[model samples]
Target: MLDIAAELHEWVRQGRDFAVATVVAVDGSAPRGPGATLAVDTGGEAVGSVSGGCVEAAVYELCRQALRDGRTVLAPFGPTADDPFATGLTCGGSIDVLVTPVPRTSPARSLTARALAAAANGRPTALARPLPSADTPEDPRPLLVHPDGAHEGTLGGPPELDRWAAHEAAALLAAGRTGTVPGCPSTGRPALFVESSAAPPRLIVFGAVDVASALVGLGAFLGYRVTVCDARPVFATPARFPAAHEVVVDWPHRYLERTEVDARTVLCVLTHDPKFDVPLLQLALRLPVAYIGAMGSRTTHEDRIRRLRETGVTEHQLKRLRSPIGLDLGARTPQETALSIAAEIVAVLRGGAGPPLTGGRTPIHHDAPGRVRRPELRPPGTARTSPRNR
Candidate 1:
């Protein structure tokens, strides 16, 4: 899986034979979504998780079998008795897993190798394989689709079918999701499973405070490429924030104005000073970043709003800023405050309300769109570099 690409890539480079079991489909409340993979080498070494801890042992055995037989299999696990020996998910959901062998000499091996390499290098890629359904014919080969309209492997289907699948996979790659798409009707396939490996989302914290250190650590743990920026060099040192991918010593506003950001980027303003917060909030609110939060009390937030309005920030743009920064978790320590902030950021990105999930009507997993809509910030006829270009 892309999550463990570094380890898997090393295994492939060492000429080790392995088998990968991927969840291609899910029904009801599955613990893991589609594209969760569990890989096992011939020597029984394993990495990654397919179904949390519910069916790992069963899946591992399936991988070992696939490696020995050099055959691909589709195994379904659910609450029913479909699979006599198959482990059932306790969460009352059903999932269909595809177990495939990746021997060094197989065509699938080359495709897997290419995908792992791309993921290791932080390149966006999609791996599309045919699901083994009753109505679908056998398709052992998988295709690797890249962002530049390039692809590897062949489905042995019509050229049109391949093009259609590539387009579908590309869309998923852009959205940073892994799921199944309807197969080509003309090709008589039931469905295709697209596993997307996109670059990690970015979290840019614009203060070198104690909270920033905790935030950078938690952001990295959540698979974000974090950057800590501040005008003060004494506080923004690498020794203070070692978890950050980059510690930038510059004005927060100026750094953000020149740095690249996309729809998935989160900008956190921890600099409570009016001199730093006002200008930074001015530029960040107008940008297309997914989240923009600033730390301050309610009274301070009101004052910051007046300053921002004085600087010509529009009312609509002002709504974009999440002042007071985090959810009301009664947090006092820097670590607990960091957790509250991270929780709010995730709630915004996942379209969740910061409330108890105990008896809520909200879906556990929000269905994200096919592609993240880019913000239209530039004026008409003004050309700006696209986020995907970065």
Candidate 2:
């Protein structure tokens, strides 16, 4: 699955056979949504997760068995009121997991490798496969779709059906979504699990301070393509923020004015200086970005708001700014502060707060309707124990 693309990319490169189980569909209150994966290698090593610790052992063995038998297995987990034997997920929701094997000699290996490599390297790609039904019950094969409507491989069906699926998949790839798409009605077929992915979201940090360096690594870890911009060339060097994908030595506002951003971009104004942050926030708040967080103290935030009011920024745009950014984690050091900021960014995007989960009866998983975000790409370790790459 694209969720564990970095690890699976390595597996394909090394020619190590493995079976990966993906949560293709969810009904009710499941822990993970579609595209979540759990993979097991030939040596019983595993990476990633598909549930909240429930049904994992069963899924793990399912992956292992898939590797041995070279068969595609569609297993269902979770408790249903009508079923007597429900082994996992007591939380009233169920998940349908599809396990596919990519052995060294399997026919699916080449296409699987191309998808994994594209996702791991932050390229746009879509992997579309059909779900089984009583009417059409052939073993689903992958069809790799690209943004330009180009595609490779086949769905083991009619050519027109494959073309229709590719067209739908290219549309989803535009939004970086991963989920089931309605099949071509002309063919009277329904449902193809289309997991489409695009380039990772952008995280632009406006300041080359020490916290900027620390936050760059955290942003990259969170799977954002990070860019550190500062006017000072000496500070905004590649050596300072080595983890960042780009380091630009230009005024923050000037650079942002020319840069391309979208709904998934995150703007972090770490330079609390009125000269830099004020002009930057003036431009950032008006842009269509997911988050606009500025680092400052409460008193500094108040002063900054006053300055923005004088600059003719509308109240609606001002309301979008999160000055004194980050959660109240009592963060002291640079790393802790970066973590707090990252947590707040995630919370804002996921519609969550910084409250402890133990006291709350709310569902643990939050499924943003009509929007599916691909999980972060975590590279696997060579260690045989503690195998999960997350």
Candidate 3:
């Protein structure tokens, strides 16, 4: 799946046949959500995970079986009435997993390689696969949806059903969200389990400072499409920010105004200068972005707040700013500082507190509404990303 695209992409290039198991549904307390993948090559080498650790062995065997038989399968992993110790989730939740084979000769192999390549490189793409069932059609089965209303493959359904499913996947891609929606309408659409994999979210850094480079790298590692913007063309060059997906020389506020953003966008104003920070933060604090953090000392923050207020920024909007960005980890180096800031971004994303978990009674995990969860991430910066997104 796209989560392990870097490795899976290589598997395709080498013409190695493989089977993939994807978590398609969840009932309760499932550690991994829909779209979580566990891929196994013909050689029995595996990458990625479907569950935290509960049902991996069973899922692994299922993938191996799929590779051998070349049959798409949908299996459930949960507590069984006769055997409580069977392959199931220990977290008291149930999940439905779909195992699909990607043989070298199958058209799906090529289609999957394309989706993986696009998603790995931060291009806006989503892969939608219908669960295998009695009415399941033959090969070239999955539907590939792009952000610009373009689609590649088909669900082998009626034209109307394919169009409708592609539309739904496109909407999910626009939001940078992946999950199960109503699948192909195969004769009343029998509630087919659909699983979608979308590109990563956005993390826009509004400064070309030394720390910006580290932040860009970390953001990509955490699965964000990173951008660096500044008004000075001299500072905002690709040579300076090789980690950034794109480097813009336009004014921070001006560039933001013309760009696309959503609820998942993270804005980091690293340009402490009032000329850059004030106007940018004023606009950012009011947008529907996920986090708005500005870099400045306490004195500079107070001055910046005063300037923002003078620009008609209301108290409600000002309350959203996270100045003096990053957690209080006594960080000094740019890498440490970037880690602290990235930690805070994740905290905000997951509704988590900045306190230590040493001896707290607070729930260890907080789930933000509609927040998409996945297994461990494969750092995007370390991979050979396609140049298309750049």
TM-score of each: 0.85, 0.81, 0.77
lDDT order of candidates, best first?
2, 1, 3
Sorted on TM-score, best first, the list reads 1, 2, 3
Q: Model 3, residue 56: displacement in angstroms?
A: 2.6
| Weakest 10 consecutive residues of candidate 2 by summed lDDT | 381-390
Give the per-residue lDDT of model 1 (tens digit) for 302-342.
99999999999999999999889998899999999999999
Which one wins by lDDT: 1 or 3?
1
Clash pairs (backbone) in predicted model 2: none
> What are the runs in model 2 whose C-alpha is more than 4 Å off?
6-18, 27-31, 40-48, 64-71, 79-86, 90-93, 103-108, 156-160, 182-187, 309-312, 372-390
| Candidate 3: C-alpha lDDT | 0.79
Question: Global lDDT for candidate 1?
Answer: 0.82
Task: Give the Cα error of residue 2 in candidate 3, in Å.
Answer: 2.3
lDDT string for model 2 (119-223, tens) is: 999889999877655444445678899999899998776787778889988988876778876554466655777887798889999999988989999999998
Clashes of each: 0, 0, 0
* lDDT against the true structure, each candidate: 0.82, 0.83, 0.79
Total backbone clashes of candidate 3, pairs 3 or more residues apart or in separate chains: 0
> Top lDDT: which candidate number?
2
